[model samples]
Target: MDLAVLRPGELTGADREVWRALQSEARALGAPQLANPFLAPEFTLAVGRCRPGVRIAVVHEGAGPVAYLPFERTALGVGRAIGLGLSDAQGVVHRPGFHWDAQELIRACGLSVLEFDHLVEGQEPFGSRKFPVFGSPVVDVDRGFDAYLRQLRARSSKFVRTTFAKERKLGRDVAPVRFVHDERDPAVLRTLMRWKSAQYRRTGRSDRFAHPWIVRLMEQLFHTRTESFTGLLSVLYAGDRPVAAHFGLRSPSVLACWFPAYDPRFARFSPGLVLHLRMAEAAAADALAYLDLGRGAKDYKNSLKTRELTVHEGMVMRRHPVALGHVARRAPVRALRHAVLARPELSGPADRLLKRVGRLRTGR
Candidate 1:
């Protein structure tokens, strides 16, 4: 196999053509999780332009393109998934017959260790070494939002009823509720960033939007207008008041849920959950198939999801000294995380601990 590494923006001409083709083929694999729009050239290029050092690997056996891998080269010969902290899904996009052999690919990429937090399950070679898989909640709206709601009602009547009831209460108590599935106002995007930043600080998580590149990436994506890949900002407004919003990347059929935050003042209204349902309704109307809520646990995700997709967090490394170091650094954290997540007893305390830390940091 011949492998060529290029900066995400450097993908052009025949390479671009093959990349698009491979992306199309990968999306056609009939799995919503596998059809990650983030892997598309447009996304990688946008991210690469904002964050330097992102490299794309194009692998070919004989003639046509077979697979593509996008990663970032960090110091100490360590590699990470292209948008490690942000990307919801990570893995090679390859055809069914594409060859395996993780070590060969790692050696070719000149990396001793490659780490991924949200690796898409089912990717060959890498799939072999995937850490404990976790459920990523998704709402498959291909059939129709009405059908989806019916299914939800069948599965969890209380959840559906309570959410709709909250939405109604929000409309009555505040101004008549309004949900715009695709909000175009740049000011609204800024609002989301602020809310997200505050939410991050309040939760003891690093504020992603504080990073200028991530902010710029969001701006670029919001302005990015494409049928196959584009930024989608959904907002729930009460009168002129924005209650909750979500900004995500979407292909023609799939929406990768990225940043979502709500005005804490309206927390009682459960605007975020209401926004998700409306988002699902709009996405289905737009001919979209799925809304991947990414990997993580949230009460809303569990309640709103029609099904679950598995994602992995771990590293695939070569037999190098740094590889062991990387493993030692990440594995313990991963083990602790999964352990905490698997048990509510541990998870609750962990969350409380994080919240306490966040309160301290925020001086709250």
Candidate 2:
């Protein structure tokens, strides 16, 4: 086996060809196409757009690419997989039966420790040593929106009825109902960013929209379309003005919900809920199998989820003394970070601080 760390521009044509071949294998093995983007050269470029330290590891056996890991080197010899917070499914892009160990990969890359926040379940080469297990909710829209709603009502009757009531009242008082599943309007994207940023501040979380690269990436993704995955901007309009919008990715069988926001000015209309309902309807019409709400425990997610899927993340440290020392020092710091941020009490204050910091940094 030959292993080497590759810089951003060092990705060769052979590398991309091998990558596409491996992606076919991954799809054959039942991996979702969303996982394919993490392995794509374009995605590597996008992450580089946000963080310049992005690196790629190409693992080869007898001149054929076996696995690819896209990561970023941070300060203090720390490394993280590319698109940690943003990616729904995180893992190495590899063919099945590939048996490289995580610790060995870390050592090969000459890294002290490798950390990932959204590592996909069942893809961990290091096994159970990884910490922090969480589940993401998904809604199956295969049969259709009405079928999905029927399942939801059967599972959580009151919740569905209540949300539907809110939707009805919203339409009655606000304006006639309007939903665009694949809206290409840039204004809807802008509305989503504004609402998402406000929600982040209101809840004491770091506003992802505050990042210029993230904003730019969303803009770029909105215009680009691919067979396996394409950008989707779903919007609900009230009297020709968008009241709620969701920006997400759609593969043939799944809609990976990302940023969703509604106008606070029309809060009484429950536009967010209305938008989700419409999205579900659209997903069913599109013959998509699932709507991934991503990792989080929001009331809406709980109410809409037909099932939950587990995901995990952890650090894999090389056995070297330097790596061990770094892990020893940083583990507690990471724990503290999670502790402080995870607490409900700190959420509001943390969001406020992040918003203030974001404003200072961006002057927005």
Candidate 3:
């Protein structure tokens, strides 16, 4: 096989078509992770437009392209998943049985080290280098919203009942509540971003919207609409005021959950959960199959998820000094994070500590 690297926007019209076909075929062949909108070529193209150094590696065998990898390169010869830190699904979009040496791929990309988190499963070579695996929760809505509700109620009847009760009370206490599954208004998008930014700082996490590129990328994605990839902004409103909102990406079969936040004033109403339930209903109505909640441990995920998917995180490296230096700086941090995540006992304390730090950061 031969590898050709080019910017994501450099793919010819025919090549883009072929890329979509490859992704669809891969999904049918049992790699459902390919269904993630984040793995779509359009996503790469959007990121390429907003961020510099975004490239796509096309792998060709004999007469045609068989796989693609979208990544970002840095000046120091370091590489990362395209939209790394933001993208929840990362890996090569390859044919079912294609395989390559991890180090060889790294060399071909002209990088000494390639790093990724939330790397999709079934990715060999790189999977061999993974530090730990995390469970990404997903809501299976293929059988329609009603069926999913039945399953959810079966799993946590009280949680479902209480959430529904809160939704009704939210309507009565605030205003008549309503949900909009596909909101096109840009103003509401900005509102969601502001809420998300405040949420990040409040939780002692880096605010993603503080970066110009991430903000520009989301704006670009908001206008992106296609069969393989579409930006979906769903909102739960009390009368005319949006109580909670979510902006995620969707392919025909799967909706990859991304940014979700709600007005802090509505915290008691559980607006976030209410928004997710409505989003799932809308996704099912749109004939989508799954709502990928992304890899994270949160109470809402535990309450709503129908099942879990495994995603790995780590690096693929070549024998270079840059690679060694990158590993030395990152491995310990990654190890500590995984250790904490693996044990609820440790995770609770860590969370509490972070919140305390958050309070200080927010001057509260």
Candidate 4:
């Protein structure tokens, strides 16, 4: 096998087509999670447009391309999964039974360390090095949204009852509730960024929109539409006033839920939940099979998810000083996180502490 690394933008038209074909083959071969639009070449190109460090390693065996790994590399030789924090799915998209030396790939990419937070399952070498695996919540709508609703109702009837009740109350008290599944309006996208930024600050999290590149990336994706990978913006409105919105990426079979936020003034109405339900319905109607809620522990995800997909997090490092340094620097924090996640008892207190810190940070 021969490996070559190039900027995401440098991928030829043929390369992009081959990459998509590989992803499609993987999805068809029973790894439906490979359908995630985040893993699509378009997403890598989009991020590459904004981030100069973005590169892809293409491995060819004999006559054809067999594998592709998209990643971002810093000047200091630290590599990250493409789009890193923003991308929920990470790893190489390759043919069945393909394998490569992790260290060899790293050196070829000129990377000392390759880090991934949401590496999809079945990724060997890296999967072997993964920390405690985490379940990314998923809503399986293969049989359609109605079937999912029936299952959800059977599992969490009160949650469904209460959320829909809030939706009704919101429509009655504010205005008639309406939902737009694929909103094309740029103004609504701007509104979503504002709401999401405020939400981040309120929750003691770094605001992704504060970074110019991420903002630019979002704008680029909003206008990006293709058969296999398209940016979807769903908004829930009370008459003319938008209450909640979600901006995510979708392929033919899977919708990868990303940024979701709501107007705080409408919090009492639980507009976020209302928007999610509507999004799920729209996803099913679009013939999508799964709505990947991303790897996170949240009440809404728990209530709506029919099952969970396993995603790993870890690093692939070459034998180098920088690799050792990177691991040492990150180990403590990673260990603490794994410990907390392993013990449900630590999760609540950790979350409450973060919220309290957020209050202090925001002076609320």
Candidate 5:
């Protein structure tokens, strides 16, 4: 096996085709699952376009490209999965039967450590230390929205009823509600960024949009349209007024839900839930199979999920200070996250604390 490192922007036309082909062929253990869009060339390339540290490692067997590994190498030689925080699925996207030593890959990349959360299932050779498997909630809509709603209603009748009633009430209180499957307005994206940032500050979580590179990347993706993957901004409107919105990426079969936010004044109306319902309806119509709500322990996920996908959180590392630094900085945070996810009783206070902090940040 041979490995060739190429800057994402430096890939030639031929290299790109092979990279895309390898990505298209990667499946979870060659199962029937669709190719994860996070691993696609378009995503990594977009990240690279915004972030200079991003690179792609094309793994070759003989003369054929068989795998594409995307990662970020920091100035200190510490590496991580590309777009670690924004990317919901992380892995070495290899073709079937193309496995390699994780440690060797780290050494070859000249990295002291490679860390990741949200590592996709069926990724082998990563580590012996595995974090607790958490469900990334998914709503399968392959059979159509009505059929999907029936499944949701069966699982949580009250949740279904309350959400539907909220949608109806929102429509009545405001104007007749409308959902735009793809809203092309850049202003809407900016609004989402502001709302999402405020949401982060309010929750005491790091606001990813605080980073300029992330902002640039979102803008690029918003304008990017492709057959394999398209950046979709779904906006729910009340009359002519936008009430709730979501910005996500969609492959042919999967919609990767990213950031979703709503006007706080409409919190009572639960417009966010309305937004998701419209997303499901639109996605089903677009022939999408699933809405990946991503890995987390939010109450909304519990109520909305029809199924779950397991994503691992851990790192593969060499014995070095970079690795130790990562372990030191992240272990305690991960411990807190684990506790919050594991114990439902703590979630309320946590949410309240986040809101309080956010209020403080905003001087409210």
Candidate 6:
């Protein structure tokens, strides 16, 4: 097998052909994120505008593409998959049964450590790294909303009944219910941005909406479509005014939940939760298999989750001295994270500290 390193703009016609070939194989193999349009070169270009280190490593076996790893190299030789944190799946796109060693891939990239936060279980090249597992709530939407609601009621009767009762109360007292799917309205996007920014500020976190490139990327993604997936913009309106909105990527089988926001004015009504129920209904009608509410342990995700899947983010460090030193210094931070994960009570202070550190680093 031969390996090649490619920069963002250096991808040639041959590279694109190889990428498409791998994507076709990924689709046939039912490897979800590997086949996603977000992994495409164009999408990566848009993400790279906000995150500049994105790159690709392609592996070939006798003139045929065998695997492709999309990654970003950060300072101090720390490499992570492109769109980490936000992407639900991570790792190389490899043909089935293609068993290249993880260490070999790390060497190929010349990376001291390759870390990922959303690596699909059993697909980690470096084997398992101890990390927290959070339930990613998924609503099976193939049989349509009625069928889904029936299953939900059967499994968790009280939960479903209460949410519905709340939904009714919201509509009756707060506002009239209205849903818009695949909405092309620019104003809806602006509303989402404002709400998301406010939410970040309230939480004392850096607002991703403040990035101009990210804003442009979402706008671009909303209009872009493919045979298997289309970017969806869903909004819940109250008396002709949008109060809750979600922007995400949807294929025929999955809705990869991304940015979701709701007007603070309607916080008492829990517009975000109401919006999710409506999103599920729309997804069911669209014949999706699952609504992938991305990782993180929130009470709402727990309320909606019927099952749990394990994902991880850790790395096998190369033996370079500098890399070892970096790992040693970062080990205490990793340990702190593990401690917080083990004891949820510690999360409040730990999260505040991490946010402060991030702000200090980014000057945000």
Highest TM-score: give the candidate number. 3
Could you give candidate 1's per-residue lDDT for residues 230-267 as a string of tens digits? 89899999999999999999887789999999999999
Q: What lDDT is reached at residue 296 by model 1?
A: 87
TM-score to true structure, per model: 0.94, 0.84, 0.97, 0.96, 0.93, 0.85
- What is the alpha-carbon lDDT for the whole of candidate 2? 0.76
**Whose lDDT is greatest here?**
3
Model 3: lDDT of residue 320? 92
What's the best-to-worst order under TM-score?
Answer: 3, 4, 1, 5, 6, 2
Q: The CA-based lDDT of model 1 is what?
A: 0.85
- Angstrom error of the Cα, residue 30, model 4: value is 1.5
* Model 5 regions more than 4 Å off: 23-29, 32-34, 345-348
> On residues 163-225, what C-alpha lDDT tens digit does candidate 3 reach at each position?
999999998899999999999999999999999999988988888999998889989999999
Cα lDDT of candidate 6 equals 0.74
C-alpha RMSD of candidate 5: 2.1
Residue pairs with backbone atoms closer than 3 Å in model 6 (clashes): none
Candidate 4: worst 10 consecutive residues by lDDT? 123-132
- Where is model 5 poorest over a 10-residue stretch in terms of lDDT? 25-34
Per-residue error at 19 for model 5, in Å? 3.3
Q: Write the per-residue lDDT of candidate 6 for residues 1-364, one digit (tens) a residue.
A: 4788787787777777666666556645767556545556556655665677888888888757777778888666778777775677667767777777878887888888877777765564567655445445566676778887787788788877777676677778867788888888888888898888877766667788787877887877787776655778999887788888999887656687889999877777777878888899888777666787877777777666556656676666788875687678777887776778778679877778766765665566
lDDT of each: 0.85, 0.76, 0.90, 0.89, 0.83, 0.74
Candidate 3 backbone collisions, by pair: none
Give the C-alpha lDDT of model 5.
Answer: 0.83
Clashes of each: 0, 2, 0, 0, 1, 0
Record all residue pairs in model 1 with backbone atoms less than 3 Å apart, i.e. clashing: none
Clashes of 1: 0
Candidate 3 vs candidate 5, lDDT winner: 3
State which candidate, 2 or 4, has the greater TM-score. Answer: 4
lDDT of 4 by residue, 194-233 (tens): 9999888887788889999999999999999986789999
